[model samples]
Target: MLNIADTLHDWCRAARPFALATVVQVSGSAPLPVGTALAVDGDGNVVGSVSGGCVEAAVYELCQEVLKGDAPPTRARFGYSDDDAFAVGLTCGGELDVLVQRIDPADQPHLTAALGEVTSGRPVAVAQIVDGPEGLLGRTLSVSGDGSTEAGAGGGEEWEAVAAAQAGALLRAGRTGRVEVGGDAATCPERLSVLVHTHASRPRMLIFGAVDFAGALSEIGRFLGYRVTVCDARPVFATAARFPHADEVVADWPHRYLAATEVDARTAVCVLTHDAKFDVPLLRLALGLPVGYVGAMGSRRTHTQRLELLRTAAVPEEHLARLHSPIGLDLGAHTPEETALSIAAEITAHTHGGSGAPLSWSTGPIHRRQSAAR
Candidate 1:
């Protein structure tokens, strides 16, 4: 699985055989989502998790069974039991459909290559036949972001081609889900259910300031699985030592650095430099970009002044409205750490379309289905 690709690749390179238990489907309020995987090697060593400790021991035993030579690829389901509190199931009132399959680098070369691509930060997707005919079970179709595809041994070429195309579409959308293939079609007679798992590079978090708040925000960004970069015009303040959590520290003008950096719809831009000289140019450009979030830190008075300056500079009213001036939610935060939390909360709420209100005040489900692009 891409979540633990580095460790799996290491085990693979060492010629160690292992069994992977992947969560193919989830129902109800589950802790983990689909494509979450747990791997167990021949020596009883484990690398990843499927249910976040709720059903790990049972999955581990399933992995051991899969590791046996005579074992075939299998599926197992775990859910809460109203009558049996001691039963091996999820106590969180959720259901997980897990597929256990043995993986040997020599046998599953496509999977090994996919794992390597994931570790190298390249986009890759893998489609595995989780439910299908006995002969098709465990067969895989690997698709790269560049449109290249490979199929495992012993599957109908037409079926593999269709599966590969579906995998590529899911990969482009950055989603991990299921696709129904085969069955009374021209491709193949046997019906098959495939789980397509996409592995994309981490989203970017561009923090445009070298202040203490920027340092704290960078730490939170990294914890949220972002590839954080801190940039500032002041070379002395932008040193890596000042922001140890940032993946990159650039001593360049914020506007210039942002102009040269690659950003997508998932990128988050934070302008912590409240000064007019830095904030005007940077916020002007950031608000016009296609990034998911663009927030600037400042007081109400400063925000009014910045808006006037931007308006004078010919920035459109629509673009100016996109700016989250005086950034972060109203958390009554004063310390840098608490301020970072507020900013992170705002960014998350924006990304997930949350109301920025307390969950207790809402009546609907706590978790909303996220978009594939997110």
Candidate 2:
């Protein structure tokens, strides 16, 4: 899918006037999450999706209305029931609230710059006054990774300070949502609800194996928007041709490679080389790192042996607890493709704090705690 910034960059470069429709709020099993956007240009070209395929036509019409000035920057709601007189409703049984606005570069300078930063692979957050007085409607302010503001109109320095601080916090969490903030001190009654949307760099997934399962998992990881790298000590097996989906293929010892490479809080390390010499050292380093996930694929017996080696290596008890040995969910997966699915599903569940239980036995919101991005 094309990201919001990609859509904006394409339209701006083409000098096209378009309307951007964003799903700013959703309730009850909505197809898409907040920050999902769809752009429609004057030529009726559509890019991106919000609500999957259920409400695009309705949103497209709303975009045209905003582009034609028939509607001001407006919030359109779609409910599950078709009982309403409106021509469109979400058949998927959910509620979606979308904000449609014309993207005029001359008027939305900060948004333009924010889009550029996003397209250039820099983290940025755009805070838009979604609800407030008429004068503040459609106003936006953006903050980049280095704590620099894109500089736009919203309120006085006080308001900017609060909003920028909030934006920075949300950026760190990679969260997007509405936050209530008061206007200038003198106009305390002038409250505003700002929607802070954060765009962060894609997370990384390092798979230390060149096996068939590693290849399948690499493809799945890339599909999930992760930068996947496949590394193995044996050059014969660690060729790019073996793992076509991987972003990088390195013919190096897993432990030596990880010692020199960068692993952040968003990186996932998969130790698939079940050989004791290779996986033992690799996993010892992986578990000690602050990476988001560290999984090693092996059998129950192999895992028991590996654990003994890690303990002998003096890996802290808490760090050993972080390892997902005998990796992947209990899906009875016997094939490479199915095993990949199980591993990827486990990683996703871990990342989102899921129970790995069936939805039939689940309750509460289907989406994760935080809203999804475009």
Candidate 3:
């Protein structure tokens, strides 16, 4: 699966066959999301995980069975078992539907190509027939970010096209989920269920000031799987040596660099300049963009002044409300590293719709199901 693309690609390049068990669906308090995978090679080597630690032993045995060639591509379900404590199930009281299949590069060229795209950092979605009629099981169709598609051999051409289109729609939204096709009068006559797993590029985290705080934030952002970029007008402050963890250190005007960069709905824009000349113009542009999070570093008084300045400059009230000025949670953080943690926590809360309160103080499900748009 794309989640462990690098290891899978390496196995493929070495002409090794492996069995992959991917989580295609989840219900209740599942710890891992769909698209999570576990792969087992012929030598009994394993990489990746499906449900943290629970249900892994069962999934691993399934992978081994799949690699032994005795079993065909199959689906297995695991859930909590109250009647039997020794049962092979999840302790978290959640359910997962896992699809186990073999990946041999010589036999599955389409999957090899898809894995190559994922390891190369290109956006791609692979739709596999998880459930379908005979001769259609394990059929795959890969859709690239540019809208081009390639279907694997064997399966009806009409079904392949439908799967490709569905994969493309899911890729555009950067989501991984299942789609039911066929059996419909408008599409195909046979019923088929496809699981589309999208491998999108890492979301961007644009830090608009290259200060001590920026250095700390760049590390945290990278750890959180963001493509971090630190930008500032001061060349001395924006050097690569200052923020070694940053994917890119740009010595350009904050607003100019931001205007030229690519931004999407998943991108997070953090303005740490704290200066009127840099913060005002840069934030004015960032607030208008369709980014996920836009936070600025400042005190209450500075935030008040910045708001008045933006209002005077004709910025809309709706856009202004989206800004998280006097940024970060009420963590009482003093050091730069602590401040970065506070900011990251705020951004995560915003993204996941958390109340930013302590878990002990909150009731109900600890893990909320995030939107597909995320």
Candidate 4:
């Protein structure tokens, strides 16, 4: 799975044989989404999780069976409800389709190459034949954004092409899931299901101030899996020693650097400089871009003044509406750590399409759309 590729690669490098159980599909209210994995080594060591602790024992047992050669790579489904006969069901009343397959030490070298792409901030997709003819089971192929591919043994050239094409399609769209391939005259001619899992680099978070609050927020952003960059015009304040958690520290005017930066819909821009000269120009550029979230730190009075300056600068009303001034949720935070937590919470909610409402006030599946699979 993409989330555990680092751990899996390490195990392979150590020449340890392991069985990887991946949740390939789900329905109803599931505990985890597709591409989630749970691995068990020969010594019974485990890494990552699939069911948030609900159905791990069952998945672990299945991994053990695969490790012992008692079974081939197999697809399994688990479902439980309040009235089910078996006691082993997701407490959330969801169903999960899991695939368990053994990994050999010889396959590690090939896999490590793919992992390198992911850790180096490139987009990659790994396609595994989870269900098909006997000969194709457990076969895998990885495709990166540069159109390079890596395939495991036992896969024919024709099948590799088909899988790579499908993986490339998903990679372009930045998606992960199972796709039906083959059955065509030029290919295997027998339809098969391939689980195409994609791994994209972490999202970017650009903080436009190097204050104490910036350091705290950078730490929280890193913990939340964001590539944080702290930028300011002052080099003295924007030092690696000052903000160790930030992935980069740029000593340039916020507007000048952001104008040349590439941002997609997943990028978040936080204007924490709080000065009219810096905040006005930076917000003017950020609000026009197609970013996920754009928030500025200021009091009510300061926000009001900034709005007037933005309006005078010809910023559209629609763009102005996208700004979240007086940034962060109303957690009544005063300390740097507390304020950082509040801001990170707001960013998380915004990225995941959450309402920032209390869970007790919400009703429905908790994981309704928590993952990128959908």
Please, what is the whole-model Cα lDDT of each candidate in the order they appear? Answer: 0.87, 0.82, 0.88, 0.86
- lDDT (Cα, tens digit) per residue for candidate 1, span 92-128: 7778799998988777777788889998889999998
C-alpha RMSD in Å of predicted model 4 compared with the true structure = 3.4
Q: Report how far off residue 78 is in candidate 2 (Å).
A: 2.4
Model 1 spans > 4 angstroms off:
14-16, 69-72, 120-122, 131-134, 165-193, 308-321, 362-374
1-374: candidate 2 lDDT, tens digit per residue = 12568878766766677888887778877877777889988888888888888888989998888888635688889877667634477776678888788776655576777888888988999887677776666567889998887656444545566678788888876677778777657534578777888887778899998999999999999999899999999999999888999999999999999999977878999989899999888888888888999999999999999999999998889999999989999999999999999999999999878899999897766765454332
Query: Against the true structure, whose lDDT is highest?
Result: 3
Per-residue lDDT of candidate 3, residues 216-272 (tens digit):
999999999999999999998889998999999999999999899999888999999
Q: Highest TM-score, which number?
A: 3
Candidate 2 global lDDT: 0.82
**Model 3 quality (TM-score):** 0.91
Ranking by lDDT: 3, 1, 4, 2
Question: Over 4 Å off in model 3, which ranges?
Answer: 84-86, 132-135, 190-192
- Which of 1 and 4 is the better model by lDDT? 1
Superposed by TM-score, candidate 4 places the C-alpha of residue 273 at a distance from the truth, in angstroms, of: 1.8
Clashing pairs in 1: none
CA shift at 32, candidate 2, in angstroms? 0.4
Per-residue lDDT, model 4, residue 71, is 70
